[model samples]
Target chain A: MRRMAAIIGCGAVQVGKYPDRLESELALDAVRMALLDAGIEKGQAEGIFTTPDLRGGIGLQANLLCEYLRITPKSMAEMTCGAVAAGLTVKTAVNEIMLGQIDVAVCYGAERECSIEWFKHFGSALFEPVALQPYASYGIIWAYAMSARRYMHETGAKEEHFAMAAVRNRRNARHSPVAAFKAPIAIEDVLESRNLCSPIKLLDSSASLDGAAAVVVASAEFARRVCPKPVYIMGWGQYHDNSCIIPTDRCDKSISSFVATREAAAAAFRVAGINPEDVDVAEVYAPFSPHELIIPEDIGWFEKGEMVKAIETGETEIGGKIPVNTDGGLLSRGHPWAVTPFYQTINVVRQLRGEAGENQVPDARIGLVHCEGGMMNNVFVLILGSE
Target chain B: MSKVDFAWPASRHTPSGREFWAGLKKRKLLANKCQLCGEMFFPPRLCCPACLGDRLEWFELSGKGTLYSWTEVFFAGPEFKTPFLLGLVDLAEGVGRIASRIAGAEAGELKIGMPVRFTFVDAGEDFTIYCVTPDTG
Candidate 1:
């Protein structure tokens, strides 16, 4: 049996929809809360991993954490994995502890993502404006819209079928104290919302918001000694895909997301030695509404063209057959790019510990957390459980 | 009947647009064939990053193609006065090309994999715009 690296204490703080401009200060607040929750002194932290969005300026996140917490670890690194960054960082910290490199590590993410200049452009103009248009133009919306349109066309799914995913998530978010969009949204409201990309209205998408969350992952020995109860990292997997189109453009391979998600899910399940049904809760990243339908199938929830019935029937909602994104998901929880996955992990850890108040699933044991970056260009899947 | 402006098509041009126009003037649809792997790209590329080869050749394409996928964009930006049909047209030379406005179809009338032919129109001032029109089989 693989030696487990226990998650001693997980602390997440959601400031509000529109928070202050101080990235490092917000991050410091989260770190303080996390260390307080873990009941550990700063000097005891043996390693640190930070996932900071655009702000916190450059290369200063780890130093900032070190200065604020006064925890100078022998090893420190800042990772940028978009929404899944912190969760991946936490997994990395656990792996380090397993390797005997560090005993205690803190993984954190802080960002004021809502109002920041969200556009980023780097190098070359082979495609000019197409490659560097300001308003999230990376052919990403096109890809998602295309897949969603195809799925709808093939399955005879109505616009309401897709809107229900958002409506349900928003309703769940109403129960979440920290969710960005807490107000209830209806199918009619979503259908009438301004269309960003065709068939993908603004209401059907995740908000670009500002917030921070942090978690403490420690060695099994340290966790057993220090924390109240610890969740174990049962499995973790990640995969990559091509940056450009291939010769034969098949959706399964050319997209890379399908392959990446499948491979990661397989590897994670193998490490945990369990099937999809063993997972009581799942938090798969679905920034776009259609992806909420696509990812579950890719990860072996059900076959293709099968999610609509499942999702529409409330089987994917809280207290349903399987509780997914009971924390409202990125759809209603907001996507601050690199800070999303930490929020996802927080929910997973909460459910596993039965700490999730309003959206708790009974006797929750194993939880799966997933984060997709650049529309499945990179997928990271992690499975955690109570021992 | 309402009079519409058709004399000058509002054309946008990039380096790719400029090349596609110049080639169209010569009755040729253009593609950038990767010098190393011999793969053709409709949007044109400066280098074949796939093969890591900088050498690329401008090959005249067989304008004959079929629509791979299509969408009728109901809501459009300022540049598009009307909600027009946009399609990813696959060229006979093995490249998926993006073009605007299917010539003979109303909104929601176009189907995927329909045969199409390349058409070029003057956009005033020694310029032209390229799009795909339905091909009569």
Candidate 2:
């Protein structure tokens, strides 16, 4: 018989600049907090999973993390799928527990990207040298800006529409004490911000920070014995695009609507036996403001070209039809790459447990968390429920 | 503590990639076509990405395409000037797309599906690169 997995504990540190601490140190802090939250000892964890560090020379980050925590795990693996690695790590842990290989699994991620002088260097290294380097400067922002430009042409969505997303996420961040940027912003402020790339103002981009987040997953049998309230991991799904190179090899011609997100969402919803309308809250990983407007439509929450209307009509706001990014998302909470998705998952758990004091959705029972990385190449979706 | 300055080292290319870069110096735009599948690949590849067939042949392109998308990069690496237009151009043959700096047009005036043609430009240190400009014809 197949077993079920539940998230018994979640922990995260403040999302902001932490130049004084090492990445492993930050990860260890979150892991210790998660164990305390789960009411378990270090010996209870049977497996360890971690997202790989962007900084090179860290061989087998998961094992290194285990050593730092002083816990020898029977099975450990490092996830390196860029931003989606956090969600993918959780999914892998859940599967490992469901397959009866482990009773409890811990997944965590940490990053110190903001302290690096040339963070763009790490981003540009992912591109094909001979083909894409000569044309584009080979940075992450340029890719998103190109996609935003195309999205504008297709949907007739103005720059103000993207500014709305930035303003809203920043506004929501005011409720989150751990968010990187708590100051509420206006649409004019976003529009007047410095332009990093065309149509992608500096305020529209997510700020990378040094932080860590962790979660403990356990078998349903184990959770019932020790845990009081466990957020059930109803379903999870992951998908990758045709190629990591720009202008996907497939004939999809869509610059904004990523097929991988749609596939991942569809699989998650199918496994959960639920529809998009059944979701009480959602936390989407949108590093850019334009992505905040594009991803909901791609996930089938709204129709094509209708997301802007939904945004303008207050349908996606905190008190509207479906509250999204209640923890301010990556845009305001600070995107630490691999660790960002764990924040999303933890926020969903908070909402389900009615622990999100000010940002709580009324009686939220089921929530969704989605994350993607690498020019929309990889997408991971998770569905969590209270029951 | 003190601030440190660093330079990014040059990237090494594969044998197939070396031929593609060398063609740029001679103002020759080359693509690899799979003999078995008849699929064309830009930034020429040794084996077909689709069929993985090794029977590949080199072909010259018309240097013509339409602008699929573009962005004016205000912040970039040390090697590039700020506020330059970078574009993704879809080749006319529908084989693949090319990404490069777009010249001969202002950032505001560029539009999706605008016709563009390829050109070769000399970077410092004997390195040549491919650029795209608005096709007048």
Best by DockQ: 2
iRMSD for every model: 6.6, 3.2
Segments of candidate 1 deviating more than 4 angstroms: A1-3, A81-84, A114-139, A244-257, B1-29, B34-51, B64-86, B89-92, B95-106, B116-137
Model 2 segments more than 4 A misplaced = A1-3, A114-118, A123-125, A129-132, A248-251, B1-11
Compared with the true structure, what per-residue lDDT tens digits does model 2 show for residues A44-121?
899898887777736577777777778888778887777888888888888788777999999998888642344565
Clashing pairs in 1: A82-A337, A82-A338, A83-A337, A83-A341
Q: List the residue pairs that clash in candidate 2.
A: A135-B99, A135-B100
User: How far in Å is the alpha carbon of A104 misplaced in model 1?
Assistant: 1.5
Q: What is the TM-score of chain B in candidate 2?
A: 0.85
lDDT of 2 at A2: 21
Q: What TM-score does prediction 1 earn?
A: 0.84
Q: lDDT of model 2 at residue A278?
A: 93
